[model samples]
Target: MATNSIKQPLWAVVLLLPTLSSCGSMAAWWTDIGPSFVLQNASTGLLTHSLCHSNNTPLYPTDPPVAFKTKYAPKNGTSLTATGWYDTMTTWASLFYQNNNDDIVNAVYKCNFETGTYEEIESDVISDRSGTPPPNAQTGLSVALLGQQEGYRVFYHDRARALHTLKFTQVENWSYGNPISTSTNRSGLALGSMFSGVRNVTVVTPKDVANIETIRLNIDNAWHITTFPTPLRGSNVTNLSNLTSLPYDTSSPPPFSLQGWDGNPKAIGIAIDTVLTRHIFYIGTDKAVHSYAAFVTGLTESGFRAQPDQSNEYWPLADEPNSDFAIASHLGSSTIRLYYLSGGQLIEAKYKNGNWDPASRLVVANTTVFTNNTGPVEEDNGLSTGAKAGIGVGVTVGALLLITGGVAAWILRKKKSTTSDVEAHGDEGASTTAGGAMGATQPASTAQSPDVASQHAEIARTGSGLSTEKWDTDVKDMALTPPPRELESPNLASELPQGIDRNELPTKHHITELP
Candidate 1:
């Protein structure tokens, strides 16, 4: 009987090969799920698809992502954290934090679809018990690292009492592997008084991945700024200040008189509208949410500054969100969202129509409390309700269909209708041509003008608009290609022995300003 059973499975396996092979050859699962994978690359001002959604379901409200908690968010609410999203072939949201021991911190984590968890793909600490803790380490400690181009990490070192930026690229196993990269210290950019007022960094995509820059705000001085461009040889931190009390408008200078913030701005977040200009949002120390329009003017002079508008542009004054907390925009748009944990309950808020709307407390289940040691295993798909409905309907009506094995499972689809929709959903014949000639890679255009096709191909590799040959090597390995091993030279390692010259100014160059 056992031999017969084994033989039966073998026969079934032999019969199933052709059917499975046919299905594999014709389907385009990756392209259909492309939109759900929108990744924002703050460096290049571009967005790409994520690896997680490449061959599976798209991420969205209708599809609803399954959250996989990392082994990072603590069992208790004690540590401070930082997070941001990047656009590549997919949209990936990354949250970084320090463990109570200051020595523990993962560089990057990827969201897992099958298990609905965030797993660490890289850890940055060089030594187990290294470095002095940050200022808030003893009484309170936090780890905040903003992801940037060329695998650079912008984090605050509390023990050292400074904000330092380190840029390193990882290859092979992410166990803090051999680095083939570089680093430049940016402590001066957010030094002393600067760090005093600043709380968080909000990455903005001013233009497509080519002209990406960070807008730094000194909450205490109400100062705003961006970093100097490359080949300057060191960190050239530029202070963006206009003598006028109000903020500068990206399109045109602010017109007329405006009521400015009388109190110091504390908590800050930035978002860009559909037109691609930036809008600055912050909560003043006086407990008021404020808005500003930031711009760099006097292209020939050192005159970059922020114009704080206190007109009807501000929101949630006095009565709402009066505590210290964190704010982040949702995955896709400029609409800002806020999160805070009170009494072990998580609550959220949003900015709408120039006012803040409070969201009900997020009821995280008892069994689902994401802890430090244990990660978020899987998300509840809310399938029990569907199961109940299926049972209530009974199975009698489909008995004949089940016996004939002819009932096809329903396929999920997005609502957007356009040429993109057609490409995402695929032609009716996509399922039958996966491994076939239908899905073969196409030759990129060799047109003259600005080389848009090559640009897309370059974006596909480095997740940026700026072309990178070194990053192309990293991309090839991440794509599961066999990478050639070479010796790790000291020069190839990422390090900046000499710190930055804090006083350098940015050069003036103009692109067509957004309308």
Candidate 2:
């Protein structure tokens, strides 16, 4: 009787092993999907720099060695813009600009973090195609990496108002997609306004592309954001075809509208943090910089709400503004950095602890660097907002074990009582059969342990480089801030073009434009 009681409790423990193993697997999956903070140490090095024009003195200190320099003078008519991302230990930068022949070209270069040396891939001619006219040559370009396999895709809008895309998979392999229009007319998407991050890509334009009405891409990889029909300018509704539309078929209508979209596509930029939070910066018609935050829901739904934030009048008030801006989320930290061009200088502002830090100039006016402002892109820093939540799951597992232990004790007590009754009845043979059944369950438990341990090992290996203690500390410091107060009125709406209604604009626009 005593031996039977001991055996019954052991069998109960073996049955609970699978449940414990599942808890560990859930914890690891939570960590895997979180934001990456792998490149925290790589950003300290000096970046390449040059004067915007030859005659001007260097704006930043020359002590930090320049990574690369351009011989062309800004005053002599040159156009240049740069975008970059980090791929593990390698920092990749792509520059797109108008060359001496007034044609657009793309140059790709990789920098080894350990060596700090730049290797340039042979430059590729992106413009000057057979059917493309001189006026329709590329005017602006933006590049984004779609993981390591897809390489990079470059976006631009031409003079004919058509959106064009060029993909570069390797040094010699380049492919161009057909041109697409944002409106029914020949007018296409705006120049230098398309931006992409992770799985999401957005373009800001005054009109719709093809029959698609929204400017954002959802999880379906189709143009499916719910939006009001673009305001009509004239009676003609031409059915212009978009030759460059992505190969995917669009069969479903978008479910929701792009929040805070004011129908203007000019002077806008976007960035996504490690956890997929989106920040959009734009020069409002008031000539001040305004930012909006879009919170993602599930895999496909996003709530785009206007952030109650705006910068002083730091942007130019010109019709065709030369100012541009970029955004990046600091690695391993909740800090978000905004870099913009103002008065020919590179100015930076930080958003942390729920407030925007005052803007400070980093490089003097006209100092140029090949930075798109979307910081190191490829580091899988094993830290993210979701990873921090996994700690809570660990606590819950402990509670589950406690409950399971109590159940085992109760079962043991019942078995002991049954054994005593059986001994009194002289049913020794029945007790032996029950003990054999318990022993038979042991092999299945043995088989499952190896698989469970293998899964646990894999997750541990993936997160081995990250420190859980440091990740927890960083998350606690980055608690979400409350929404900001709305801007005061007499704002950007007063400066809008004739067709736009001021009532449709946000209320209380209290912001000043920058010089």
Of the candidates shown, which would achieve the greatest lDDT relative to the real structure?
Answer: 2
Over 1-515, each residue of candidate 2 has an lDDT whose tens digit, in order, gives: 00011122211311211111100000000001111110000122112332111000112212222333222211112233454432212233455555556565665444332223345543556665455434333244444443222444666565655555665443324566434343323222333322232334554433333222234443334433222222223322212333332222235544443333344433345554434455656544344565555564433334454566544532223222323344444311234554444543345455543556555444221112123321111111122222212211222110101112223333345334211111211132122122111100000001123344333222111101111111111111222132111111111111111111111111111112111
Runs of candidate 2 exceeding 4 Å displacement: 1-59, 62-81, 86-90, 110-121, 128-138, 170-172, 180-199, 206-214, 217-266, 299-303, 310-322, 329-335, 341-345, 352-355, 363-515
How does residue 207 of candidate 2 score in lDDT?
A: 36
TM-scores for every candidate against the unseen true structure: 0.37, 0.45
Query: Judged by lDDT against the true structure, how good is candidate 1?
Result: 0.25
lDDT of each: 0.25, 0.32
Off by over 4 Å in 1: 1-79, 82-93, 112-115, 120-149, 157-160, 171-267, 272-276, 296-322, 330-333, 340-515
Cα error, residue 318 of model 1, in Å, equals 7.6
TM for candidate 1 is 0.37
Give candidates' CA RMSD values in order.
19.6, 25.7
lDDT of 1 by residue, 68-117 (tens): 23343322222233332212211133333334454434434443432223
- Evaluated with TM-score, which candidate comes out highest? 2
